[model samples]
Target chain A: MASAERIGIRSDRDILLARQRGRELGRSVGFVATDLTLIATAISELARNIVLYAREGVIELRVVTEDSHRGLVIVARDHGPGIVDVNRAMQDGYSTSGGLGLGLPGVKRLMDGFEIHSRAGRGTTVQIAKWLRT
Target chain B: MDVPVLKQGPFLIATVQSALTDADLAQMRRLLIEQVGKFRSRGVIVDVTAVDVLDSYACRTLRDIAHMTGFRGAATVIVGIHPELAFTMVQLGLSLEGVATALDLEEGLAYLNARTRPTIARGNSPRNSAGPPRNGTHTRGKR
Candidate 1:
């Protein structure tokens, strides 16, 4: 397995970079075209959130294998003004940025596993994974 | 990268050559809206065949472009969304609600042509008699 790749996210350009890298990584893990799109879209949402809410963050991508299944893992970490209410943030159509409010919820729908940790002032971290289909 | 917006008769075609950042998209939106009014275009087509991903921001920007251009009496059509990208966009719950979409540039032009035909037939097109003649020859001849 290749070592994890890390992309620093600060602006909209970083969001695109992270998404491209995520798509490449997912493709290398044998993800189909549709699945790769999903992974890339999920990465875009996470990276954009970091840029919008945290100002700066890092997205880490890795390939993992467990037993017979191979998967891709993505971790987004940022130290910025974090979410005050995690539950509300997770809800669909709940955005504080005047957006469509589909960022977090959309990311959750795209990935197989999702986890987010945030504090009012401590920043935020989101980890998500997608397993390759046999 | 800057998207090239070409004037096609009473329509404007903005072809996105690659993945555009948020700022680039915003700029494209402004450019499209401005050109639509300046040229008195009856329709606008955004060709995204080269774009590999259309995220929420991109989708929102496209929607805005459509809405703003509509105010100028021009229809907006987005074309060349990949099949995979479409699937993922739906899964992400992202939608271009008011924006028109088609399979490719040709289809987008076809849609726009059909959409604007009624206005042209009614002689309600923004093009005035003092402007270039409305003959069919000038449609594809202009930049």
Candidate 2:
């Protein structure tokens, strides 16, 4: 676990900017289209989720390397009404509202490592990690 | 942003390459308006297969295409949206509202073909003018 560079995107404009930043960071770490797409998608979903669901949130990106293996970790946390049932939400095709239900769960599946913690009436925190080839 | 043309039967199939980002949205919106001005097309089948995501901006652009094409006596259909991507959108609570979506490319073209049926409009200009410019409909939906 290493320190991550974090940013806040309160407005929709910031979301696009953040994604561009993520892309630059991803490239420096040797991420290809597949990895870039997954990271970009995950970041977009998380950032959009924050803009839509919470007052605001933070996006954190960190570089992780060990044994010649390089990877990136992304964590998004929102201080909104926490999810009551994280498990139920993780279930594919389960959506609270109308659109596709792939936001959180989709990001989880796309990443190499995923962890989420949310308490009712509290806030929700999602962390995702993806590996990069040297 | 690149607009690649694939010739289908009796119609030009325009596939928008790259993600339907703010830039592409702007371009598509312009083309749609231009198409309406020219009034010379059977219909257009938009293949979004290469696109993995469509934001609110893209959604607005799609809506614009559907509306503008309707006025031009042509129709548009969106196809190849990944199920997972669709699912995520649903969760995000974004709505394309009336824009048609197909499971695959073939299905999308068929839907557009079926809707080539004509509809009339008095004049053609952009509607839903309140939102900020998205894809470079500059000073309007400009990105």
Candidate 3:
């Protein structure tokens, strides 16, 4: 079991770096090409949210196993204006940044396990994981 | 890095050589639209063969480029979306609605040529009158 990797997200460049790292981690966890793309895309959406709303954040990538099943986990954390309405944020086509509003929902759909913790004026944290299929 | 936009006859082709940041995509959009108007191009092809991920921002930028270029009287086609990327995009609900896509650069050019032929035939512009002949070779069958 290798240690987790953390990438600071402060700009658009960090978004790219985070996703690339997520893909590499997913590959090491035995994810296929399609699954790796899914993981990378999910990371991009999460990291972009940090850049767009928080202006700074960290993306933590880790490889885990449970009962012989291998998986990759991603945790995106930011200390910025948190979500006023978590449910609304989860809804499709509900964007506050004039975006497509598919970021959170899209990430949820891509990963097998999804969790979000946020507080207004405090920050937001999203944890997503994808398990490898045996 | 800036994506290189090459002028191919009456079209502009921008090839994305690697993973592009959001800023890079926005800049490319601006450049493509500017060059399309500057060169009076009839079509634009964005080749993303080397891009490994097409996230929401990238997808939206491509669609915006297509729409913006369309307003300038040039059609836009996105090419070289990997199979895995396409699947992931679909799952993410990034439909890329109203944006044309092809398998690769060749198919994109063919589609663009087929689409632009009718307007040229209608004598929209005398400059494009000497464009490629009306051959059936460029016609993509049943797609």
Index of the highest-lDDT prediction: 3
DockQ of each: 0.73, 0.08, 0.86
Q: Give the per-residue lDDT of model 2 (tens digit) for B70-142.
A: 6776667777777655764554455677777788778876776666533212221346245544553433221
lDDT of 1 by residue, B1-143 (tens): 89999998999999999889999999999999999979999999999889888889899999999999999889999999989888888989989998899999899989998888753456534565347666663433333
Which regions of candidate 3 fall more than 4 Å away from where they truly are?
Answer: B118-143
- Return the TM-score for candidate 2, rounded to 2 decimals: 0.60
- Quick one: best TM-score, which candidate? 3
lDDT of 3 by residue, A4-111 (tens): 899999999999999998888787777899999999999999999999999999999989878988899899999999999999999999999988988899889989
Order of candidates by lDDT, top first?
3, 1, 2
Q: Model 2 segments beyond 4 Å from truth? A: A1-4, B1-42, B45-73, B77-143
Model 1: lDDT to the true structure: 0.89
Provide the overall lDDT of each model, using Cα atoms, as 2-decimal numbers. 0.89, 0.69, 0.91
